[model samples]
Target: MFTLPFSALALSLCASAASALNSKRHASLAQRIKSEQPALRSPVWHGLGRDTNFQITDNCTGSTFFDCFDYFTDADPTHGDVVFVNESDAWSLGLVSTTPTQSFLRVDNSTSLPSGQGRNSVRLGTKKTYDGALFVLDVEHMPFGCATWPAFWTVSQTQPWPLGGEIDIVEGVNLNPLNQMTLHTGPGCAPNTSASDYTGQQLGTTCPSSDGANAGCGFLDRSNTSYGAGLNAAGGGVFAMHWDGGGVSIWHWTHDEQPCDLADLSGSPDPSGWGTPAAAWVANGCSPYTYLTDHQAIIETTLCGDWANSNYAAAGCPGTCSDAVMDPSNFNDAYWQINYFSVFVES
Candidate 1:
């Protein structure tokens, strides 16, 4: 038998303890990997020919929302009778609030007054601009009322509207229950409806700015649950927009029907795996890369805007747009409750 000195024995014990700790740590890591195996197996690219995977680059919620977006205090460029409030004003006026789990952007629903400029609301735009990427919004409620015109869209920060392009993911006016997705580009770019894969009805073939207001190629989702009151009754849902060199596409999924892939926040999103989109605009005579660029996400609720006002008669709402918008009680449901809004970039 070999006898070791006291110091040598102590050193051996210390080495054994360290080895045990390391082994335990490795085993814990292995267990985590095993638990996440199912999610890891999901494809990152759905055969889009892009070698990169989509990873969440921004998760805008709660405090993160304020950090990512800037409040627009300027008048509505769409000729909406709206008074866009700043961050401080929004909170003070109860137009905006954030909890640990959710965020709220709402219009004034407690006061009764004439709709002159419009109701008090908040309009938020992302501070950072994006060229092409994936945008996903998990909403619990969206603004919808007799005189409300709410929109979740994107536009190029560049000067000259439409020339920089605009993409309206969720937009409607008055009592419209369905969403209308549209794309407005500079010129030459148009919806190749024949080549696009979607369930929406194409309203136009041209996307030039010269086509006039609401002139961009449009696609209407006939599903009532895709927007407005129906959407809220169904407990809200997820709206996803995928933009790349191929073109831009939009998808909607009811809260309960959302794909399992989207439930895993840590996993990469694969748009290719998503079935036929609700609306898609494939490049035709024009190049998407040139038409859509430097766009920033925007969320706003305007009262009796150009769209809502012009279509008021058809909406069958009592009185004029201004009259309907002035009643605070009527706009109690005119608010947006967002669970989360995320942006993903190619990896």
Candidate 2:
């Protein structure tokens, strides 16, 4: 568990105070998780129930592009969880795409349990709305190798880019050697003040890679741990982000970390400084945050190209190849061994 500086801690509580509605949303979110979904786990995954409450069935409902819109549209499907995972259809939605073949989102985890392509991302808009809840991301496997980029993030269902803040709960780049948590804000914001806080873990630092509006974006590689440089191997850990109504906080706890706080969901963000769009930023199909405080719903697993494919294979093809992606034999596919995806509420 990572500890937040006194300043961050204070700001977190403030954020929670503002978005009290989120508390109720959390309740509704938990109820949505019905027992089973025939379309969820597919046979190719060869999954075995790791826990009682959770079951990885071998049944994927394809991409949410065609079906996902149904959730909020006219032709709603008859299903259980109303899954919106990225799949073949997702590649066409401009929401999910893989290079070379556009089949980027993997179909396999540790137990040979396949993933459902792009994470289950929902659009947050004026018509479709919610209060507050935990966005549970099923710990699916990630492309394990040197030059592989994967991400599990959220977009504002309303605005285009920075108009809504971009909360990157999970993201790793080509051989980044670390998981970088970033926020892409547009204009109407300070320059140097774009990126603030500890991008890295204990005894670590956040090194901003780009300039311009995306300056706030950076990676958190915890090499100082006794585990050595990095190891996103067979068993991947939980990469979480606590979005306090005000400010936002992120952490990477692979069953490790010193001052880590998984219980704190209170994040405080500058409403006025949520970020506008800057011409210098690259946010194509990349949606930003819009009053991201009011939480609701539980989002699950998915593999996305825009955020995951560090090699940008969807664009054309990445030069670097990994055993996991290019040749599975050469590389070991890191399984985000998922036990139970649950959201706790304040009794």
- Evaluate all candidate structures by whole-model CA lDDT and list the values in order: 0.79, 0.33
Task: For residues 78-142, write the lDDT of model 2, one tens digit per residue.
Answer: 12111243344434443333232111233232222123222222221122222222333323245
Query: How do the residues 1-347 of candidate 1 rate in per-residue lDDT, one tens digit apiece?
Result: 11111123334554565587566666667785665343322122234742458877788876556678999999888777678999898989989988876789998998788647477889999998999999998888999979899999999998478888899999999999899999998867755555337778887777886524556888898788999999999888789998877778898877666654564456677777566787887754556778988999999898887789899989889999888767888889999998788899888
lDDT of 1: 0.79
Superposition TM-score, candidate 1 onto the true structure: 0.84
lDDT: worst 10-residue window of model 2: 271-280
Q: What is the TM-score of each candidate against the true structure?
A: 0.84, 0.41
What would the C-alpha RMSD of candidate 1 be, to one decimal place?
12.5
Deviation in Å, model 2, residue 305 alpha carbon: 6.7
Alpha-carbon RMSD of each model: 12.5, 17.6
Model 1 misplaced stretches (Cα beyond 4 Å): 1-52, 115-117, 211-213
